[model samples]
Target: MKAFDWQLQKNGYIPMSGQIVDASLVSAPKQRNTEVEKEAIKAGKTGREIWPNEPNKAAQKDMDARWTLKMGGKIRYRSDGTSLPQIALPVFGYKSHIAVDRRFGFIRESALTSAVQADGRMLPRLVTTGNTSSGVWADSAYRSQKNETGLALRMLVSRIHRRKPAGKPMPHNIVRANAAKSAIRAHVEHVFAHQKNRFGLFIRTIGIARAMAKLILANIAYNFDRLVFHQRA
Candidate 1:
């Protein structure tokens, strides 16, 4: 994938525009385990260690898959037109993180983790210096003093969206600014939408290593499709 990206640069498909970083959960079959077994898994014990007597059973169990609360699905409403609050649902599987170029919309970098991982921590790993623009865009979840500092250290401009002040109505200026940022940040969503809807991406594997390989292949396929589109244009 790195080689192909480099070749794209040589061929004038460089990611001159800034990059957008985000992650999405790829669903997998939920594991059925007892409380004790779940505790052991949470403690970082291997499947063989937890189920030492049942090698066949251990081989079938996916110890790496995890549970995470997916926030903000469809908004429901009451009969009177009042809207209900968004609910967070538990989703079990892996998380795929990708850095997409704003200009060409190629998946330049990707990482995979258990569904429980934090999206904020993965931001730095996905950013690359190859982009001509230094600006970075992401949702408020990626906003923090640490990330802001990190971006500054890397000489990258921080265009990450900010959250509203807690318990207070969002200031109009911030709401407007985030709205504009959303317009640009939204380009990355197309990549995820295409992969999930078109490639039917899901983790049917056992460990994070296998899951990572699966995500890498999906990203590569997405990039190839993106490249072809650019070529046709």
Candidate 2:
């Protein structure tokens, strides 16, 4: 596949997506729920069936075909860099656009949205990827000078249209205003990590759009889970 060049505008966003499923619904032959794994070990049914195998037929097929649709991308680290791998599940897939508060792990504003791209769109998603209600932030992968010129122009137009009230400042000042809006909107990484670490869930699908949907659902579920747990405690 041909790779495309991307850039991160001073103001960009990173949209996130995920999925949630019942532990019993995944079809892996060696599937072992952590709860089941412990019980089976106690019953002397202990085997490698509980944990995932790299070469198992079920694992390989699921990994290739359904993982992304079911699970969604998970963050991982390698010798080279970090990767978002798939996690499998049943029923729902969620795609969310979040903007975070840079000074804290709070979400400023977010839209629970859906994606139309199989591999997903580069700019629309990234430019809106944050929990901030103000501006956006993203990496170089989301921005490009050539292919995304139209989108860039659109964003510029939108920014201009949303410019501050009259008797305020000039365009450059508004640019700086947008930049400042993004200043407190840089905490998405920690939010992503919290979602991953707390849920122990990640992407597991091969279909890109389905995977994106799965991701969105997970975030919604995570928030609800926290609310419920915190209330009881």
Candidate 3:
């Protein structure tokens, strides 16, 4: 991936239209363990330490991939016209943090983390200094004073979506502004959709290192596919 980024840099393929940053959960096989085992996993106990005698079970255990609640799967509705509440489903896996060039829709930068990691924290790492436009966009999850300050430090403009205050409705103007940002932010979803739908992205591996390796290859494959797409067009 570093080589590919260098290639894009040396060849002037990055058009400076800025980039969009977001992350997708790469679901993995759910591990079934006792409450004590779960607590030990959260407490940073290695699989070997947790299961000293059973080498086979210890090897199969995945301590690096954590669990997180993912909301907004399928929208359910009542028999009437109203929609039901969105349930938060518990997903066990890792996250693929990616920044895609706005002009070409190619994955420019990426990182892998446990599913429990916050999306907001990965913003700085996923951002690329190569995007000459100095403009960035993302969902409200990436919106924070620190991120705003960081962007300012780099002289990058932020089109990140704004968050509504707790117990308060969003103002009409801000709501419209966020909607406009979403229009541009929506392009990043294509990269993810293509990976999930066409590439069938999922993790069957038991450890973070292996799962990340799979994701890295998947990202490279996606770039090759994107290259083919532009060449044909």
Please rank every candidate by lDDT, starting with the best.
1, 3, 2
TM-score of each: 0.94, 0.34, 0.92
Provide the overall lDDT of each model, using Cα atoms, as 2-decimal numbers.
0.89, 0.37, 0.87
Winner on TM-score between 2 and 3 is 3
Clashes of each: 0, 48, 0
Tell me model 2's lDDT, rounded to 2 decimals: 0.37
Question: How does model 2 score by TM-score?
Answer: 0.34
Model 2, 174-229: lDDT tens digits are: 55755653443334554555666776555466333455456556655654453455
Regions more than 4 Å wrong, model 2: 1-60, 63-121, 126-134, 156-185, 204-210, 223-233
> Best-fitting candidate, measured by TM-score?
1
Give the Å error, residue 22, model 1: 0.6
